[model samples]
Structures are given as structure tokens and as C-alpha cells.
Target: MNAIPGARPPDPKDLVRVRDRLTFLFVERCTVNRESNAISIADGHGIAHVPAAALSVLLLGPGVRITHSAVSVLSESGSTIVWVGENGVRYYAHGSPPSRSSRLLEAQARAVSDPSLRLAVARSMYLMRFSGEDVSKLSLQQLRGREGARIRRLYRQHSQRTGVPWDGREYDPDNFEGGSLVNQALSAANSAVYGVIHAVIVALGCSPGLGFVHNGNYRSFVYDIADLYKADLTIPIAFDIAAGPLTEAVGSAARKKVRDSVREFRLLERCVADIKGLLSIAGPVDIDDEELIVDDLRLWDDREGTVAAGVSYEESAEL
Candidate 1:
């Protein structure tokens, strides 16, 4: 261990689990470098040190200068590094998934490829959203209609609770400022949850493009997963923030509220559980999450589950 510099690389178990990490850290007009195992940020604001391992998403905004060492440490820590545009929230790039195992990812692919199974997965997602509501008898179209109604109701409820005016959801991605105040807050809040969900989705090695409910985009699965929590996580926060006094700080304020709500609801932990449950991965209800991330090396044999990965079976083949 002494041969290693700036403290030893952390054991996998010692590193914080993806579900428990702090939501995000935004850095703009700052320089980022690795100091020991932490990331050092220097800017006109001052200097600060943040534990790289504790970060979920590190948003590098405008006027940011980052060192290679800093990127390396953040990647090693399983923290997502997002490069944004001049406005500070546009997404560009991110870090790789942390999972070494493909168990769940394979399950996802198999489920998504089959039409019936994919519908089944989508139905399961609906159940998660509605909880006690019975959706097994409904087709995807019916479910979609129901979901739309549910969201509209949520918008109304939040609007009344926060006393914020409810206009229909409308916004152009290219023109954030053109939207109304409530719309802007909703967009910002949704983006925050979407970013966190994107990190979780990729960290699990599941295909972001392989969505059961929503499809076509690269982050289809991210959109699908994010929708599950939007009613609880972002919708209310957005309305609450919008109802407050208008200021230039509204976007950041909405994101901050969403971050707090994420922790309060333990959204990350629920998200991981919901995904595993939806995919119908074979396991106990209380299976330890740590066990799922371990790489279970095996050679595929259609009928059999595990074959020795290192063995040569050429001579034993029927051919």
C-alpha cells in the first residue's frame, strides 16, 4: 500500500454505493484537479475540496478547466462527469457505467426484444407508478391514457398546493427563457431528476436506449425511470419554487429542492429496487444490492446456466 501515492485506492466495499451518493456538484469558471483522493476546485469564489467518491454527478459548466488526474479519480469513484454548455445545464458527455456484471443488463435486453415481455415490463412500471391501481387488465394504450390523466391530476394538485398558476406544459429545449416561470421551474426540476436517473441507469450497465414504455431516444430508459418519481420528486418542487418570488436564481433553487427531495424520498434506493423488480431478475425480495454488482463470469450454454469460462469445449462439441 505504501508504494501507492496519495492514499491507497479504496476497496470496492469501502466506496459509497451508487444509491447513497450526494446528487450532484456543479462547477463553473473553476479549475478542477485531484488532491489525494479528493477533487480540488479553485475559482474566484474561493477554494474547496470535495470527496470524489461521494459525488453522483459532477456537472462541468461554462469556463471550466479540469485536469486529467481529476477526471481519472472521478471515473474511478463511479461519479458521472457531465460537460454542459455556456448556459450551465445543457448535457454533453458523461462517465461510464460502474457495474462489471451484465446479469441485469442481459435481462433488460431479452425483455425489451420480445414484444409480449416488453409490454409486461411496461405494465409493471405502471403498477409502480399507481401503486394499488390494477393495470394488469389494461393494454399499453389504456395505460398511457391513464398515466396522462394521472400526471395532469398531479399538476393540478401541486398547482393548488403551491398556489402557482397552472398553464399547460410547454417549453422549447432551445429556448428555455421563452417558457413561463412555472414551465421553466418544471423543466429545471425534471432535468435534475433526469440527470440523477441517467447516472443510475448507466451505472447498472442497462441500455439507456432500451426502454419498455418510452422509446426511440438514447435516454428512453432514463425517461421511463424518471417518470416513476416525477409525481413525487420534481412536480411539487417545481410548483413550489415557481410560486415563490421570481429571481435569476430560480433554476438553481429548483435543482436544490429536487436534490433535497431525492434524499428525503430515498429515491435512488427505490429506483434500483424498482428496476430489478421490473426486469424480474431471479432473487430474494431482500437480496443484498452489493451482491448484484459482482462479476459472475460464465460461458453461455442455452439450456444450462453456468459453464466454466476458462474451459475449452471444442473437443466435446457435437460437431
Candidate 2:
């Protein structure tokens, strides 16, 4: 890689707002290179130019070779890059850290740290999955029972609708082939949906590890959020795929369906709105207000509320 005559860093103020940007873009088996600001994807088919600044998330699946220049441009644009397995099952992700604002992350940390707030956030998420019922009075264990029943009903309903066999959900992560056809389909569909939801989480500056309901794993929040849409989006699609004639490429089919469904239902936009609502944010996360984008670094001071980050405080510390 060599420096170009007119190359320059992207202006932060001029970059597209996160909410306005396109959702996750999945690419596999391609060569990624930089052509000025846009990323060039070259594969067996050909090369295509994609504006890195316009994408919120870039999913790099298996068989992809990316360049340093490509990484630099994408990072400057604030796009989140993820490395994943087939059907968007995440393996690793890095790049273009969400440095714009700490509002959502701080709020999430506070909420999770407090037991009461954590319960309330969990209740809010459960309600999102089934708006018809009021589980505000229920405990976490009760909520889990109700959710389990609801998901079971959904599985039965989709199985009937798609004429797929009704069997219990069972799958081993290490051995994908051990599961039945429907189970395999469900796994593939869920993975695809999770990938997209994970992208949204990163774009909004939320920690995938700090979950309100589901916890323990690094992607606890990702699983928590993806649960909201499973009954509506992925489950039915999975059943339908299972109903179709068997294919050796069931995983590929599932991925394709999930991608099309996401685009068709505008799941990214709705996903963004749902997350903001759950987090108690008043409006779209990416607003055009100058004050929101400007750097306002500060230090936490319990007694005085805050102090400037950059200034030396050795005298105050001694006093």
C-alpha cells in the first residue's frame, strides 16, 4: 500500500449518522481492498465498490482476505466489522469502535449494576416479545416460564403452518448434523438473525456482554435482543425451509432466507427503534444535533458530580 496524492482522513462531522446508515452487509469468499474512501470487493464474479462510510456493520465471513488500507478507511468511517462463520454465526469481530457517544453504554452499565433496574429492563424486554400480555407483576422465573410456553406455542404453530414435523428443540453446537432437519433449520435461522442483531448492538454502542435477562456469556445481550424477533421472523422461516425438499446445502438456504427477510421487513430499522425504546431513550440514537456529536470528556466525581478529563488534578488529590 502506498499513499495517494489526494488522500485525506474523513471528516467526522460529515460522516453519515449511524441511524441513517445501511444495516449489516455480509460478504464472504472475497478480496477486500481500498479504492479511495470506498471498499472494493473482488471475488470469482468480479469487483464492486461499496462506500464504507454508509455501512453500519460489515460482516466478513469465511474465505475473505482484507487489506490494511481497507481496515483504516472502514475504521475512520465508524463501521463495525465482524468475523463470522457460515450463516453469520459470529466467531470474532473488531474495528471502527463505537467512539461517538457513551450515552447508551453508560446507561446499560448502570441498569445492569442495580438489581432492581436489571429486573425492570428484563421485564421490559419480555413485554416487547409479547405486547398482548402484561408481565410487569411477574418475577424473573415466572417470566421465563411464560416465555418458554410462548415459544413452544410458536414452534407448534409454525410446524403446522409449514407442514414440518413437530418435535422438541434439540441441537448440539459442536455437532450441527446431529439435529433433525427442522432443528438444523432453526439453528441456521437463529444464527443469521443473531448476527444482524449483534451488528445493531455494536452500532448503538451497547455492550453485548451486559445483558438484562440472559447473562454469563460474552454475547448475552445479543441472545436477549434476538429473542424478541424469533417468534415472528426466524421461526416461521425456519419451519418453511424444513418443509421444503431436503438439500445438502440447508445452511446456505437458511442464510439466504434470513438475509431476504431482514431486508424485506426492514428489521434493522425496527430493531434499532425497539432497542432504544427498551433502553428508555427518547428518540432515534443518531440525532443530527451538534451537541450530541461534540466531545465532552469528563471524570466522575461523586461529591462534585464531574471534573474535566485532561486537566491535572494532583493538587486536588493531595488536598
Q: Return the TM-score for candidate 1, rounded to 2 decimals.
A: 0.89
Instruction: For model 2, give the 10-residue run with minimal summed lDDT.
Output: 282-291
Worst 10 residues of 1 by lDDT: 281-290
lDDT of 2 by residue, 32-129 (tens): 99998999999999999999988777888899999998988888787878888765554676564545566777777878888877877888888777
Candidate 2: clashing pairs of residues: none
State the displacement of the C-alpha of residue 58, model 1, in Å, after optimal TM-score superposition: 1.5
Off by over 4 Å in 1: 1-9, 86-89, 281-288, 292-298, 301-318
For model 2, what is the error of residue 90's alpha carbon versus the real structure, in angstroms, after optimal superposition? 4.4
Clashes of 1: 0
Every candidate's CA RMSD: 3.0, 3.7
How far out, in Å, is residue 294 in model 1? 3.8
Candidate 1 has an lDDT of: 0.80
